[model samples]
Target: MTRALSAFLVLFGLIAPALAAPQNKDGDSAEAIDLLTQASKAVRRETYRGIIVYLRQGDVDTLKVVHRYYDHEEQERLISMSGQVREVIRKGDKVTSILPDHELVLVSEHPPKSMLGGMSHFSPKRLKANYQVVDLGTARTAGRDCRVIAIRPRDKFRYGYKMLIDSKTQLPLKLNLLHHGKRLEQMMFTDIAFPDHIPDSEFVPSYDVHGFRIVRHQAVHVSESASDKREEQWHATNLPPGFKLAEDGVRQLTSDASVRQMLFTDGVATVSAFIAPAGLRAPLKGATRMGAVHAYGDIVDDTQITVVGEVPAITARRIAQNLVQEKNTAKKAPAAND
Candidate 1:
């Protein structure tokens, strides 16, 4: 029975490795989640200053930002190197978009939905549903130990991404848009630091110009209705991995006089489609690719459909081409009175 005992031991050894793998995976996942949670909280709590660069197809500009936060209130000052110095101070959803050129501050209620806000959307639970997040070892960035996580899309309706988060603070040090396993776009922190004390005066605007124009814009609200729900009657039979119907509405565009608006999101990225009745001008044909943004215009019957998104070119084209209108009535339907 010695041979039998040896065979049993071999089987046990093989099973042990398999059993241990799941526990290891669980541990890694928990650590990643913890990092993400802490980073989200840190962004809202910490105050500092640094230089940030926005890179896209046609435009490249570096800007300096100084932010101060206290009592759940934040004041931010932004200076553009290429253009005039502009300052924006935001308290909650209300923001003042300052323009030094006109010496005016335009008030708006949106958060500018910037790269910082985009990073804020990286919630561990919401992201886990659409992406398979795994730590791809570790590396040093900006003098910090960064744990790299590859967010692989589960479907073709969306693209994939990779993010590097600081091991100690959990803040994202780098973000990359992946295409076919390669980076199509990337945002990396050239230099970063967390300071304990930020001067309050730095948060205030620098210039004072008399007789400046102050333009205040109102916030647009989205409502749920049959017309809004059936705005384009659009359904994408094929989409890149991870995309879903994020929003839809009816609105008029300058190019087209008709009212139509549709929004789609793949959690991380979003695309807005606007359709309307064609103007008196002839139908236009062509496509334009602008950095991360792609715009496509086509005529569906007499309706002009335009699709814009920060996704790839092909994705924008496919979505614009698939625009359709659904009829409201069936053949010989009974009247409500009957």
Candidate 2:
């Protein structure tokens, strides 16, 4: 997939170890769960603006974000403060990205709840099975007193997260993505403000995109008949503990080609499995890692199988290796251009 398309899909899709602090014995787990639940709600229900620093691998970038929640709908705009000049505007599910360096614009539909910070609706009760939530005491971020919380993985199949939530507004001020006690990626707000009212003009792009090359990715929902057939044709026989199939459908990337996708999640972590016809491009064999995101690919029954997620490399490989394509269920579709 193109970088823009991958980003759009992945959005519709990490953290660090904690310092030595006294763990609360009483009400710690319950408090951590409550805090996380509040933070998730705050992300969608509050209007705020801030400067965020995003670090992945060894590179860093800065962004200015303006978010507004009104009438039960959310709108946000992010402008690059460092590196290439770019902007992203998200109103509900439709996302418009403006790349000034390339003079390109990408318009695509994504899940409305997907945020640039990667926080989404999650079930605290369900997450308990695979991750241990703990209150890591207090810390300060963005000049606000915050409560530190850690969601530690029970096994190596998944990663961990450390969050510093504003004590007053319950907004997440900093988030760290961790693997094996090492940091993979980190996003922290350098400055933030919760405003009483944010005008609509704040969400508009600052640059004129009238002459930029525009690419639109349309999502074609599968018919009921096709969806039933898809369920029978693809499945993962072996999945890690607590992981369940959350979404399954076929997405039309282009007019002539479609890809079958199945999304699996353990409440806190998610994995996506994609199946497209072979020869669309060179198949992505074996495994690869881009920061915290791991992808594994293989070929099955003349189809290309790629499993991608922000989980461990082994988790992606296991999911890719266990996919089973039923025989004679349906004919292969047209190849998708990656």
Candidate 3:
């Protein structure tokens, strides 16, 4: 599945240690959970606007974000403050990305919620099961006192997270993505304010509409097959522990019905498998690595299979090389009456 998370990862994305953290004598394990839960809830319950400094390697981006929820409806706008005039506006499930540099307006439908939207779907119980939740005391972020929490993974399948959560509001102020003891990406709020009310005009796109091309990605022609058939056609016999098949589907990208997709995740990390006719898309020769994201591709039985993820190159290659074309025995089997 090409999700909002993957789109975000394509531009910005990490792993951490597998060792468990030694907790302090006075700290309770559940306190970490409570703090994370509060942070998740605060995304929807509060209206805030801030300047976010996103850093990945030598690339740094200053983004201004305004997010609010009114009458059960959520709206958000993110604009690049440096470099190109790029912007992404989201209202509910509709996402509109305006790239002034490219002079193109791309529109697509995304999920109602995403990890970038402060994942409310993230389960603390699942996190505890897959990681070691550590409370690292307190610090100051965005001029507000914050409680520090570090969620380190127990295996190589997922990434680690360190967050400075606002003490009173329970909002995240500074977040770091770690991998193998190194920080790969960082998100910190320089200045932020939670308001009693946010204006609707803040969500509007003030970009020039004249002479710009608009592409409706939401209207893409995709013919879907049964989910069961998709599962039968593709199988990941070997997967990292704690990772599971989150979603799978077979869909025609255009006029052909050979394109298939499968999504796997360990809650913290996600990977995508795309299978299609060899001639349908550009064949990935060997492997490519960019920052934290990696992709590998190969041709099997005259079909192209590509695996992509924000993971180690070894992990990406392993997933790509292990693509197995399992026969759909369920659909081929004779009926009970037969």
Question: For residues 1-338, what per-residue lDDT tens digits would candidate 1 score against the true structure?
Answer: 11111111121222112222221332335455455555545555566667655554445556666655677675666666555566666666677667877778788674444212233333333344555556687988767789876656655545676767778766566666676786665655567777887877776667674578888764433434435655446544355444555555543333434355676655555677776677645565558875556788887666777888766776777777655566522322321210
lDDT of 2 by residue, 132-233 (tens): 778899988889999998878888889888878899988787878789999998888899999899998898788888899999876534446556664446
> Candidate 1 vs candidate 3: which has greater lDDT?
3
Error of 1 at 312 (Å): 2.1
RMSD of 3: 7.1
What TM-score, over all chains together, does every model reach? 0.69, 0.84, 0.81
- The better candidate by TM-score, 1 or 3, is 3
The per-residue C-alpha lDDT of model 3 at residue 23 equals 38
* Candidate 2 vs 3: which has more lDDT: 2
For residues 46-144, could you state the per-residue lDDT of candidate 3 as single tens digits? 688998887776787788888887788767888888877888887876888899888899888755333222233234344456777778999998899
Q: How many backbone clashes does candidate 1 have?
A: 10
RMSD of 2: 6.6
In model 3, the worst 10-residue window by lDDT is 11-20
